[model samples]
Target chain A: MATKRKQRMIFVIVLISGFAAATALALFAFQKNLLYFYSPSQLSEAEVTEDQLFRLGGLVVEGSVVRMPDGITTQFSLTDMQGQVQVEYTGLLPDLFREGQGIVAQGKLNASGLFVAQEVLAKHDENYMPPEVAEALKAAGGEHPVSIPKTTVE
Target chain B: MFTFLHKYASPQYFYSWSASWQKWASIIAALLMSVGLYYSLLNSPADYQQGETVRIMYVHVPAAWLSMFGYMVMASAAIVTLIWRIKVAEIMIAQCAVIGASFTALALITGMLWGKPMWGAYWVWDARLTSELVLLFLYFGVIALSGAFDDERAGARAAAILTLVGIVNIPIIHYSVEWWNTLHQGPTVSKFDSPSAHPSMLIPLLVMALAFKAYFFAVLFKRARTELLLRERNTSWVKALLKEAV
Candidate 1:
């Protein structure tokens, strides 16, 4: 009986490990496709056509937001600290959207190499603190440096 | 230790032992939840960026944590059922499935609510979100598969195998943010050494997490005890216990 139980244990372990290994190999094969969005640097190298829709994620470059005369359309530059992409979107941005904040935009590139975004979503980092604590950190010049520089103050 | 475990593994023994444990767990869970709610909703400072919307984390994160924790418990019970053919472990799988599914559903709902105002979308097909959704389906699958078989033991064995197979999704859910470029943010509380959240916020999050754990165990023990009673209805111990109750 004891030997039978041990055999069952071995069998269960082997079954689980085999399933896990198969899943791991499958995930590895489709690693690039699994990425939610491509960084500005990756977008530059990829074989993207004007007609293909894709997501671009990066920091909103400081001092790059330009509101069109119509007041609905906005143009901004997104950068991954290595490469930059010009994005134009006409919509209400999320509450967290601001200069130097990270965001993901889904859109297609136009003929002039401009990204025409249909949707813009803000992506917050892991940091969380009260307004006062943030102020204190900034005063001390020891603010938690997100990927982008803390140049714009809300 | 083995003998002790074996003794308690019996439904008759566990039924009596679990009653007082359930009572104590329920009381502690209630107390902790009250305190945790106070700290999380009132005492905790709001996020600089998210403001009051960040309060959603207290519910969302704990629910997400419990969803995974419930699966881990089910997986452990699955192993015991497979190897030892423990009757108690089999019952545990059925009981855990309903509770785990509820928590997974709660996590997903609260996440969508939080996402709309913060992430600007109600849902996204990101890796983290998608994996968590898969966990919910896995829980439902376990519950449905177990109930599908007429023979209870056979049903449990099948469910246990499925549970073991689904265990692969747990790590994927955890590391999805790091493994892929996800819209969801990375780890905050799990980092331990240098958590990004302030202590005021982190403390409340931890309190809420503990409260959820206590609540989970309380519900699990209650459900398991009731299941043990039903399963052992023909046994003499249960008859005596029922007589005593009457």
Candidate 2:
């Protein structure tokens, strides 16, 4: 009975390790596809056709927001501090949307190398503090720590 | 230690022993939950960026933590069941499935509600969200597999194997935001050295997490006791229990 139990334990370990190895390999192969969005740097490096729909994510470049004459349409530039992409969208933005905020926009590129976005999502950082604390931080010339690195492709 | 474990491993001993602790756990859970609610809802300050909606983090984060925690418990119980063939551990796997699924559902719902205003979409195919959804499905799968067989032990063994296989998803769920370009933000409180949340907000969140943990134990003990009673209905202790009730 002891030997049987030992054999069973070994069998279970082997089964689990084998299964985990297979899954790790599969996930590794699909690593690029698993990313929700591509950085501006990745977008430039990848061979993306104008008609291909994909998500572009990065910081909304400070002072790049332009509200068109039509109230709905807005244009902005996204940057990873290494590369920048111009994005235009016609939709109501989230309340969190603002210059210097990270955001992900999904759409296709146009003929003039402009990204025409169908949807845009605001991506807030991990920092959370009260308004008073934020004011103090700003007064002290400190900024909210950015958790997501600027040029992370994965 | 072995003797102590052996004594408790007996379902009859465990059934009786768990009753007193179950009462204590529920009382503690209730007390903690009240304090947690007060701190989270009224005492905590509004976030600089998210305003009042950040209060949702108290519920959402705790539920998410419990969801993962429940799975870890189930996986540990699975190991015990498979290795020692412990009847109590087998029962634990079944109980953990239902509880884990409920927590997973709660986490997903609260996350979606929080996501709508902040992220502009109620749902997204982001890595963290997607993996959590998979976890919910994995719980459902375990529950279904455990109930499929006529012999309870056989069903439990099958469920145990499945639980072990799905254990890989837990790490994926945890590190998804860091590993992939997810819309979900990275770790906040988990960062040991430099937590991103302020003390006021962090304190409430921690209190709520403790409350959830207590609640989990309360429910687990109660459910496990009932299951033990049912499973041992033909045994002498349960027969005596029934006689005493009469």
Candidate 3:
């Protein structure tokens, strides 16, 4: 009975410890590969790898929208209302996308520090905006869409 | 009926019953999972937006659903053990904890793997993801608390209290994605409206859910039986059952 009890304790310990160790090892091995989202300003100063796809968000800087001659590719500048970074996308823009509105572009940094967007999403207007977008916008500037007048905000 | 129910409350009776049930449950579970996995992986259509990556949903959704379902089972057993002083319930509760924790870990890991290709991030603080992580922690807490006390009964009672407390978090987790503006998509299956899910998607999801539930019952039955035998090794019924098997 005593030996059986000892075995039980060892079994429980091994299960928990084994899982914990495996998870820790996996996380450590992939630590650098873990993708983190960044605002346009953070990406500017952050040392981001060229291959790491990350989220970059900001207001589409007014009148900075310029499409290249290829017709498929477009270049625009994103600003946190403090700093600006150029972003390029070759895909079709999402509906509700417009200048001066919030957008999150998913892609990685190029060697020149330009954001090469694989996917571009426009933050839907006030009532449906995601919290992360709202917080990011808020931190960048007081761009709280919910608090703004519906007519004026849009 | 009362006497029959009462008989199984003893560790000795439970040990014998669990051994018999384990084999039957295992066979049923294996059969269900085989059908479910095959249909999910091969017959289902690739998602319109996600392409082949949507196939991961078959495993991810079922695992997530089972993790929650398993916790509920464990919590219910804990309540019964506490209220009725049933040794069988205690054994079931302990066994279910191990299995539930395993399912929760599987769900979290599978979700991360799916997220990498779909969401571009393996982990996110979105409401759904965070709440699921919390659920995993809750399972770990129950398992830890159960073993914390030197006296087994004391440990069980303490763990039971923790389980009851953790039940409150489940609903919060379910609605967290909806309540707060979250990046995670809302429910496709558990909805009041005509489900946004296609027939192909829905069929595989349901099959997988049933398969996972069966698997849980099978494993829990086996583990509970082992627990009962360990606790009641000196009892006459266990001895008789052992002799017969030999």
- Which scores greater on DockQ, model 1 or model 3? 1
Assess each model's interface with DockQ, reporting 2 decimals per model: 0.55, 0.76, 0.04
Backbone clash pairs for candidate 1 read none
Residues A38-122 of candidate 3: C-alpha lDDT, one tens digit per residue: 5565565657788887777667887989989999898998877666789999978864456776666889878887889998765
| Alpha-carbon local distance difference test for all models | 0.90, 0.91, 0.69
lDDT of 1: 0.90
- The best-first sequence of candidates by DockQ reads 2, 1, 3
iRMS for model 1? Answer: 4.5
Model 2, B14-61: lDDT tens digits are 888888999988998899899999999998899999999999999999
Error of 3 at B105 (Å): 1.2
Instruction: Determine the backbone clash count of candidate 2.
Output: 0
Tell me the tens digit of each residue's lDDT in model 3 across B140-221: 8888888888877778877876776667667756765444434455566776466656666787778888878878888888
For residue A55, model 1's alpha carbon misses the true position, in angstroms, by 0.4
- As a whole number from 0 to 100, the lDDT of residue B2 in candidate 3 is 40
